[model samples]
Target: MTLPSGKWRLGFDIGGTFTDFVLHEGTTGALTLHKRLTTPQDPSEAALAGLDEILAMQGIGPGDLSEIIHGTTLVTNAVIERTGARTGLIATEGFGDILEMGTEQRYDIYDLFLPFPEPLVPRDLRLEVPERIDASGRVLAGLDEAALERAGAELVGAGCEAVAIAFLHSYANPAHERRAAAILRSAFPDLAVSVSSDVVAGIGEYRRTATAAANAYVQPLMHRYLGRIETALAARGFAGALRLMHSAGGLIPLETARDFPVRLLESGPAGGALATGLFGRAAGLSDMISFDMGGTTAKAALIEDGQAAIAPEIEAARVRRFTRGSGLPIRTPVIEMIEIGAGGGSIAAIDEVGLLKVGPRSAGSDPGPACYGLGGTEPTVTDAALVLGYYDPGFFLGGRMALDAGAARRAVARVADPLGLSVEEAALGIHKVVVENMAAAARVHIVERGRDPRDFAMVGFGGAGPAHAVAVARALGI
Candidate 1:
């Protein structure tokens, strides 16, 4: 893709709670920012809405933008919510259970009842064929055409829109996988197929297989979303080159992003890290830790010497937030970071043990927080913040959207009354709990990288990041 010669560039990041924008005028190096509530029903709506408002307010038009870089957490959210398109997996014979078995190592040794994220492709949808390739890429048995065809028929019968092909040793030699994909595509030309080698090249069977499955799971959804966004932009006379932010704090074209949606999983969070790193370098800081708190979750990453730590493996949709190996291990190029389900819209409730706890659950943007007065009855971090006097109810969203303080107090009372604590006390408790949770996560996150939290300077961005950055930093003694 090529960018046209123009004086303006536009960028947007789509998050669970809000969509953020940045418009930069190349001529004067001036920048403008904007935010909008995310439209979950159709994410493109929020994106286009924000783009139009920003351009119009800044006295610019679509033709003035030479480039647009967009990123979204939709792919990762789909995996977490199990809301992607119907997907099926094809594996070598006797390996259909690889996704479930998952290396047989316990992520938490002491926690007996450990919960694992459900496999993207269920057991019944995972088909097997008579094909074998050894560890070093030796084909011990040839591909079984009849078995493959039978599996393809089963998948088609199951109404699978996407199929993932991950035969054993495909990373070393992708011959069998390529053949399987060809066979399936020939049978169903419209089916989206993701081969193991083409998605992620790795030696681990479970990681490679899971990665391919994730790509297939979200391929159809991402394809439709990107197509819709492009059409909307084009209708507005935008002729700029479109690019997507990736997990490694880099950009990729639309075609590559559509084919391998797995790489876009952490795209939005990576953008924060990159921006923080740049600002840190300009200030001549040695080690910078980036913190981004959005609507659905909070994330922290380490940047040293102007580079964010990246890994070839990432775990998605974790059952236990802080525990390692509890989620689907996707082998992709991802910026290394620790993420938790604690965020502004995270729901607060009392567990059966009569203890108050924050979320792995969220209210999202549709209803949003109770204070938003958008039909949400549950207490969220935003509501708690309102109760604790951290936000001006009348001036919320820069007065564009007013908040209801009475609703926020009532929502927080649910947790407060249960523990016989005052509403303000409960609200403060909620903030402390979430901050402690993030602080504990950050401590572990930095420790894993052979670094101390006190050794790094922290930079918090995003809508919710700045609000609690001080407490988190104090918790880490940074």
Candidate 2:
């Protein structure tokens, strides 16, 4: 690829704990990197702040950039934290419960008490209209426009911000779904809508509906977020093209992403995986494991033949973090990765079994770790790392931000005193526990594919990846 002279491009990723920015001068091929704690209230705050800081550090304006590529965990976090728009699902008559019914295959067949996440759309909001389409693209029953209008009215009356249209056999023939979407949009101009056929053209009643529902659930939020970023950049005199990273390790236009927000489920992780593949290939390693440990979670993906694996479908908002079917299954192409609930911001506590457990829960960037001195009292993996001398408190973010050692000690002591151990011991325990958790996830992800962890090199990314990479690799005997 030849560089366009004097042009600049920026790439940024918004993680749970931190937002990272990279400014590239296209002509000189120079790279400038910056990292800052994320703003949970409005993620774009951190993104734009980081962007301005980076550009200022390079003595350049936003208009100097020709393009900006952004990847964020907003959609994934919204689904997990249930902070997305209040969405309703409009499905074929008598099939409104497909989201709840699922595939009937338990994620853990041996475990009698299996848990699945609640549907994004509640039963009351899952309205049904008179519509049916057979598997062979034949319309068995024409769509009832009046029924759809009534359903839309009921949903809008109930304060629905977005709506999903998934009629039976819509994959074979999307006429009903399209017509229903058009009607809803025409009636409720402010409502964001997603149609199953538009989101996924493949066949699978439950999967298609779930994917569209997921898209609808986050459509409004993505729209607002992307719009905010664009407006902010334009205000800074930016005339560059803004592209969003999707879950499939590809870049898509802002409009396309907003319409199909479900594809952005693993947007951030996919970027990391793609980078891993690129760097791995550069290092002459065709087969490796990409380990990205950030604030909320650690994701591991296999890079074979210098490419990341793409899964046809991915689960979101899993009740059990590591359980395969304990989540809402959305049929969309995504970079296949195993996510472990162990990261820098992951909370640490003693489980009901009297054993120390690291999270499926994260402090995120709001209060962050206890050491951040942001009113967080809970002990997080970052606090443990600080207490164990793994991170220099005063030197954090190159002294741009300070970590409180006393706060870290106090936070770790809560767990240490209860376990009858010193604070340092407890911190070490926290660190070791998280490392093992990541190693275990990576082991399963690799071995299940008839490959050995030792055979594949481990390429680490994210804030915590490098810190725990060696320990995790050793734990996996790699």
lDDT of every predicted structure (CA atoms): 0.90, 0.90
* Global Cα lDDT for candidate 2: 0.90
Output the lDDT of residue 307, model 1: 84
Q: Please write out the lDDT profile of model 1 over residues 1-478, one tens digit for every residue.
A: 2333777899999999999999998878999988899999899999999999999878777877899999899999899989998999999999999999999998778888978888999999999999888888898999998899899989989999999999999888899999888888898998999999999887889888999999999999999999999888898888879999999889999999999999999999989999888999899996999999888899999999888888878888888777788889888888888894399999999999988899988998979999988899899999988888878888876787898999999999989998999999999999999999999888887897899989899998877788889989999999
CA deviation > 4 Å runs, candidate 2 = 1-6
Q: lDDT at 252 for candidate 1?
A: 97
RMSD of each: 2.2, 2.0
**Per-residue accuracy of model 2 over 123-183 as CA lDDT, tens digit each:** 9999888978899999888999999999999999999999999999888888888888888
Q: What lDDT score is found at residue 463 in candidate 1? A: 75
Looking at model 1, residue 262 earns an lDDT score of: 93
Listed in order, each prediction's TM-score against the native is 0.96, 0.97
